[model samples]
Target: MAGVESAVPGASAGPELAVDGASNPDIDLLYDINGLTKSTPDWLDRAIGFVGEYGLLIALVVLVLWCWASVRRRPEPEVSVAGLVWAPLAAGIAVLINIPIRGFVERPRPFVDHSGLELLVDGKSDFSFVSDHATLAMALGVGLFVANRKFGLIGIALALVEGFCRVFMGVHYPTDVVGGFALGTATTLLLAPLAMALLTPVVTAVSRSRAGFLVRARRVPLPHPAVDLPEPRVADDATDTGSGRNDLAA
Candidate 1:
């Protein structure tokens, strides 16, 4: 209860909740989880923290591979490339949206509000309404999925892991992660279609150029037209008989 801190005015954050009397059940649950997590082994701490820190990179690799594979399998280079490109593009939009959401919610980080909370990673003074990490993770995931369901599912899993580690490491409340998940998912889903629609022409053009050699869609949008060959001709038997009679008269 003592040494509790809230976010600065004008921008709200998750202030310190009572150990037993948090205004929101989600915050209360965070306290219990963070408290228990403090006793985890050093290796586990690092493992989860590593996942939280670099999960995006891992997800990005998966996205690239999946996109390449999609192109290879279907040869629809434009569509697969769009899926790959839209992932980070959609994530960028989600990050932009997160800026205002943080100011609006003004939730403080869990470690800032609670005493004896240990940090596995450096802490930021930013408001914790929704986590940027979680949002981007999910945004990338959803965008990738929109491009290819298999890749999208993997991306979503990575996003969930990022959220879990953020809480487990005492950097965020569960609600922060949830808000990020929702924001990321919604932003990507909305933007993916628009991105695909707008970028398709560019992608199609690129596919025809020398650079198009690199933009393998793996699947062709329209198959080439079929060709018709000429039929063969043979001499008739009656013509051959007439030729023999002329030869005899000669």
Candidate 2:
């Protein structure tokens, strides 16, 4: 009966064994990768940590500030105001979408649950489906780029660096960073137009108020000095005296 059961066309130990063995290479590779990562010098880890922490933050801040400044300098108040509104709105959307999605996916962070990675800094994150840092960096970069091309380029560069840093730091898998990039890019593109539309009315109102203030300021007569300054008196004799002296010398 055991031989008959084993001899069934569909029943086989071969497939089972193959399936079990399938994980071996992956496990071995994982171990090898982790071993290599573990051998990384301390300096590399420190550099990765620095870039992950300060580099991303500085890039984001600078991009936002640059956008705000550029918009503020515009002749129309709406453009500047709209830029301000959209930049922050885009960032907010990235956060709102990325956080919950990451939590729900619950993919283990690289070093925390996976054996093949080393983390530069330990994160409390429970999932590695998407990287929040990458999402935020990319979203901010795209938003800034939309606001101003030059600054946006800088933002994009920073975003790429940040995404790479996640992998280098060993807190996130490459797939996690890729997912984050996609989500962040999509979030920025989706929210940008909406943010602009939503901010239009507010920007218009602000522009109107600003125009009114300018009008009022122009209308406000400058207080004249208590007494008008007399015109400067020319010394009529000076030129004549100089000419006479020149003539005499001649």
Candidate 3:
């Protein structure tokens, strides 16, 4: 339960906690990555801890809202809105799905089994397999991507960083983060088409209602270019004068 402040250096850190005392890549990777925390300054470690635990997730939520605000201007507001709506829903569903898996796997926190790890945050009493943070982040990322490609890519990148943060924080093994990414991606991608099919019509209906402002804003009219008018022509006064003279001479 201790944090990076209590990290043990070198072999004195203790023995491998793998089952039957056998070493595996998962734990090895966990230690290798978590080990980096010890090399970093405590302030830096704390910063990473805050970012991994909360900052990135908050950014993702803002990204979703940002995406929603942007999609309203798109030609297909209904489609975009439907996708944006699904992003959070997917994250929620993914986290809910992880609950049963966590209970079934009952994997303990990395700090519980391993020693000398630089745990960034403390009081992690729940199971560690398929981290909820990673799951929620990736689900939102993938779901956002389904709605808007540009923003979605940013979301996915953040989610990947989030996965690394979990391992770096010493709360989860690399595989655990991978499992979360897999769960989130699969759930969002697999059910996306169906979700879109159902949600689009509802969005379209909203687009037509007084609440349409939520879907799309009024279009701004473009200004027209200026043009010069031609001048009117006038008959010569000489012709009229000559005609009068000829009549007087006659």
Candidate 4:
């Protein structure tokens, strides 16, 4: 009887909970693009992946060197000092903002979501929204540009390249990189003037100290005196005397 009752097909089951797993459409598009990049030569793939993962460190070092060169008595010392002071400052601001957002957003990585995909570099399963690379790179680029056009242009290029690489390597979404760049650029520009003002005294004092010998003028305001010094005392009387002598000789 118990078997017969069990066989009566457990009274019709209630409707099951339908879990809506809809994902952002951007993910598919970005994933498609990343896949396309893999068709390239293996050498290229490896090279690009390396750049995407590690090239920015080189870029950051280059930026620091640029600032250092400028600060160390190079042309446009004021601007150089600005670059030196602001690049790290902006990067720090970017990192600060990124950390909180990363935690709050908590997005999944592509590799984790889609297994079987080849990875050229080490990847993380943590959130990928708003890439830290893009944020910091953009901040550094903008800060450098503010200080010097040439350095700024280079920085911007480097940031753009790094963003593309982050997307190409499949570690980050296109939106993640784009959002990071936008966020970083905005934060740095907005915070730059205030940060610089607040840090000036401290930086200046440090630069002036013996330890800052590497910095030109120790951050001191130097004379950029106008090139137009009153035309060297015209020696009007000497010329007049020469004219009279010529007349007498004639």
Q: RMSD per prediction, one decimal?
A: 7.1, 11.8, 5.0, 12.7
Which of the predicted structures, 2 or 3, would earn the higher TM-score when compared with the native?
3
Error of 1 at 238 (Å): 39
Stretches off by above 4 angstroms in model 2 are: 1-41, 210-250
Model 2, 1-250: lDDT tens per residue? 0001112233222211111232665334433443454666777678767888677868688667766756665556465456555765776788788777765666655444343355567544456667778887888888777767777788888889887777766666666777878888898888677777777777677656855332112244689779888999887898989989999999
* Tens digits of per-residue lDDT for model 4, 1-250: 0001121133221221111123655666555667666467778878888787777857666876866776577633544575567777788878888887877766665555543345567636567777988888888888877777787888889999998888777777678888889988998888878877766666566666775665564457789887876766666898989999999999
Better of 2 and 3 by lDDT: 3
Per-model TM-score, in order, reads: 0.74, 0.66, 0.83, 0.70
What are the lDDT figures for the candidates, one per model? 0.73, 0.65, 0.86, 0.70
Candidate 2 residue pairs in backbone clash: 107-128, 145-152
Candidate 3 ranges beyond 4 A from true positions: 1-22, 224-250
Report clashes for each candidate as comma-separated counts: 18, 2, 0, 1
In candidate 2 the C-alpha lDDT for residue 126 amounts to 57
